[model samples]
Target chain A: MGRTEIIEKVNTVFRDVFDDDRLLIGEQTTAADVDGWDSLKHISLIEAVEEAFDMRFTMLEINGMKNVGEMITIIEQRVV
Target chain B: MNYTELEKNCTRSTEGFVDSCTLAVLGTGATQHLAKAVKGYAYSEGIALDVYDADYNQIDAQVLDPNSELCHKSPEFTLFWLCTEKLYEEFCQSKQRSDFADTVIQRVERYWNLVNGKFRTNILQCNFLQLDDRVFGNYGNKTADSFIFQLRKLNCLLMEKCLAHRNVFLIDFCYLQEKYGIDALRDSRMYYVAKLPICTRMLPEAAKQVVDVIKAVRGKIKKCVILDLDNTLWGGVIGDDGIENIQIGELGIGHAFTEFQMWLKELGKRGILLAVCSKNEEAAAREPFEKHPEMVLRMEDFAMFVANWEDKASNINYIQRTLNIGMDSMVFLDDNPFERSLVKSMIPEITVPDLPQDPSQYLEYIKGLNLFETASYSEADRERTRQYQEEAGRAAQQCQFSDYGEYLKSLEMTAKTEAFDSFHFSRIAQLTQRSNQFNLRTVRYTEQEIAQLAGDERHLTRYFTLSDKFGDYGLISVAVLDKQEDKTLFISEWLMSCRVLKRGMEEFIMDELIRTARDNGFDTVVGEYLPTAKNKMVADLYSRMGMQPAGGGRFTVQVKDYAMHQTYIRRQ
Candidate 1:
């Protein structure tokens, strides 16, 4: 999958986990950019993303991600 | 349901729920998600759950302090989730590693006593998940001080304690870990990051385990399993394949069906009624259970058996009516998806599991669903099948005689009525919880309360047992009479087993009640009928027994004016 395609799929997962249909995401979107994206919900978001992308993020990778750009970078490196 | 779906369910409004329960959850780790899952799952089961989640790792503070939020809320049910990971940290720091389980059990007993002493609540404590740190590798099983050994010992200790304590029950967390592998049950990353013991993927299943216990305690239980015969109880269609050709015994696929029948037989022994509803000639369906040498289940094992060309839904409806149980308390199992869907569409209240295609996977799948969860069992449970079989015999003979009075006389029934004693306390309490349809006022009592009533001087208690030429209906009816001031005797409880209904049992009981009132020097006998969704059958019971309506669902009859009701049962 390309970076743009991964970003679009990731955005769908975010919308689902947050229970918001119109939740869109970009490369620079951080935790601050989303509502109800606290630490507890972050775990649900990670699980939903792993299920959607069919890949697992390492513990360090999960704890170190800074933005949607970093998440997409990990998915990009692992998907192809 | 998944974690996200359960989370979404929590947002739904429980606006019109008629039944609601209060629950308090305290755990040594993060339990907010678990509380949410339990509340959401209870909503699906039509129970509005009001959950009070204690702050993380406050089990001691909340249970010990009388003025804590837990004591103030005083939930009907309190859950203690003591995880193994937290216990392991304490185990590592303890100097006496060999006595770690002992120490923990002592503390657990203290907590139970403290909470139960403060208020009357059902305590649901989670057993430790059997996690092996693998420090001693395979040798951990034999090592006394190993974490795995101590953890398993702690689980066993919890079971023994729960068995001794009447109010304590265990959530089989170890069994859950065994069902879905430990890898799926626990997430190391999530545990470390969030202090959540159970993984997000497994939260719904854990919540289901909790809610199942609560449901059983609240008298919502499955009492019967309706089975399909052709491909369900055996390998092939018995009508097409003769009894000799059907796969049932020690063969390749036959072994699977045999094991399945064995499991059903075990459930039947455990007080669950079994009935066969099949679409075939009656002779053909009886051939295997009657003549086959390798069949595990016999004809005598079933409470009722119906084989005809009728549709499965209609046959199941007949079984439910004949058995006199609610449709919600029956489970139907069929290997054919078409038949399953038809029954499901027709009867929306019955539980019909989507059985797996492979015959080998049938038993495992059914076991995983845990359909037969129960809150109590007694010695009477083992004789249930025989009682139902006797009931069937009575039904068959009733058709032989045109007059019901002749049939009752032919049976020659005799009943033993005596004051409540120590020998039958367990069964008496079980009847108070189990009987619903014939119950005048549905009031549940625990064995402890029943014992207290038996010893109290102001109360008069009687337990009745019936036996005829066919068999014995042991401890079938219970009545508690409270002596009121002003020469009045109040009937606080009157409930009989549905199996003994319409057999002059109620008449016999009313005679005994009036006799007891006269012997005790009470002037008037009073009774009440409080209606429930299931107990409408006895709404006019007081009036039927010649008691005058005293308003507010109460009835009164002077002891001197009450004539003895005629009954076929001669007192023993």
Candidate 2:
């Protein structure tokens, strides 16, 4: 998937995880970006994305996602 | 919010919702109507019913008559052969069906298993065993102690067998019928007649009722019946008649309200939040409820109290706000139908249990109600009364300060917000499962899914705990904040305890959420409101906090312009 495609897939993950459609997809969306987005949901959405994109996130990298921008960067790095 | 996403969450993925049942009815009524109710309720929750057969005549005919078709229906049908009034014990002693006796006993054993099993559908009742027979009548020759022992053995053994694999239930219609007698059964709303015994009808609907009660028992029951004082608590209003003049104890209408109070209090003890929405001035109502020698409910028995000159609907609304419960969670009770009708028209969600015109049937009427059934009952149910009492105390303590902010500060309120850990996951999951009133989004969840959510970083689950000098509320609130973009927060679920409804804990949590978002350069926070009968308190929660409704009641509290309230000092 291209960058836009990746963002679209991640946005769908965001929309699905938070149950929101108008969820914006900037370069910096993070756990703090959405409502109903908390720790109990965070890991599953990541795992879902990891499975969806055939990518994996390490504990260090997973913890490293400080913002949406950081999440996209990490997912992008893994995708490549 | 998208309907498709909501559908996917509810239908496609059963991740966040635990089907928490509210009531578990145990009765032995069988009719098509009862059956339909049973089936419908079962689809919704869980049920436990009993089955009995009337007039050993059917069994008698089956047994003594050789022409009975089931006589030769395999050796298993030999039990049918023994169904005759004459052949029961004789068949037990006979060699005619000795070959099939073991298998038949094993099949009969299955009913016992289902009776004792979990996921019991409800009881299916047929008819009472004949008065002359061993199951119903005095085992004439047998000792009472031995009969009791035999009954225990029979019931438990049968429970083990019947509830064995099907997760079905067997109601003990025989027990109650024997205890209260058939006369009382005639008055029961649940029982219906199915056979030749005109007055003593067959509860043939037991099969279907079990299904309906089970389903009805599945979801949470939001509303509860709350009582008043003076004549409401005793025979006459204390203010009008004085304490000594108030009639109570085993006398006339005095005993009536006393009995009614006992019933209301009992419901409170059973996880129902009982509020006192009395029209009387505080001293009159509170005096009898508190100091009346014959009073059943103490001040601590009630969850919320609204005592002032106000319309009943307005008082109810205040109680709804104070409890952080929805209009549907409240069932208002007063002697006046005008007030009841007025409140009913004003707030349609608040249920009004029909008050008997005569005080004699109050106890019996309340007893017949199956409103309290639900899929799950934890220790929290027993503690609910205590919790609400404690919440009331906490609110009362907040009154000492002249300024609201000063009062909030004086409470030494500490709120801890964090990701779900093993310690709080079960309860966090429970909030998703049970919270109806203040919840922003009513998404129920299972423990396993909670664990899965904890393990997944893409979804974040956080719990909020509120405590002041009064007491710590443990983990009473939870919020599901998800990432939408770098700057947008999509709120999935937000709920605070009914105990701490007015404590501004939700606001504290929102403020913290926005602070977290702002600290990270987020611009806006999104929230949704999916209306349930019990959560209208938070319908305008976002709007009150500055977020306009996007559509319907769905809205967002933004971060950039929103100034976090400094009154609530965050511990986290």
Top model by TM-score, which number?
Answer: 1
Share of the reference A-B contacts seen in candidate 1: 0.35
lDDT of 2 by residue, B280-380 (tens): 77776677656767778787877776787787778777777666655655667766677878987898877677767677776676555445544333455
TM-score of chain B of each: 0.96, 0.59
TM-scores, one per candidate: 0.95, 0.54
Docking class of 1: medium
Question: B199-312, model 1: which lDDT tens digit per residue?
Answer: 877989999999998988777888999999988999998988888899989889999999999999999999999999999999999989999999999999999999999999
Worst 10 residues of 1 chain B by lDDT: B443-452
**lDDT of all predictions:** 0.91, 0.56
The segments of candidate 1 whose C-alpha lies over 4 angstroms from its true place after superposition are A26-33, B452-459, B482-489
Candidate 2: where are CA atoms >4 Å away? Answer: A1-80, B1-218, B250-253, B307-310, B382-406, B416-430, B445-463, B479-494, B498-572
Can you tell me the CAPRI class of model 2? incorrect
**Cα deviation of B309 in candidate 1 (Å)?**
1.2
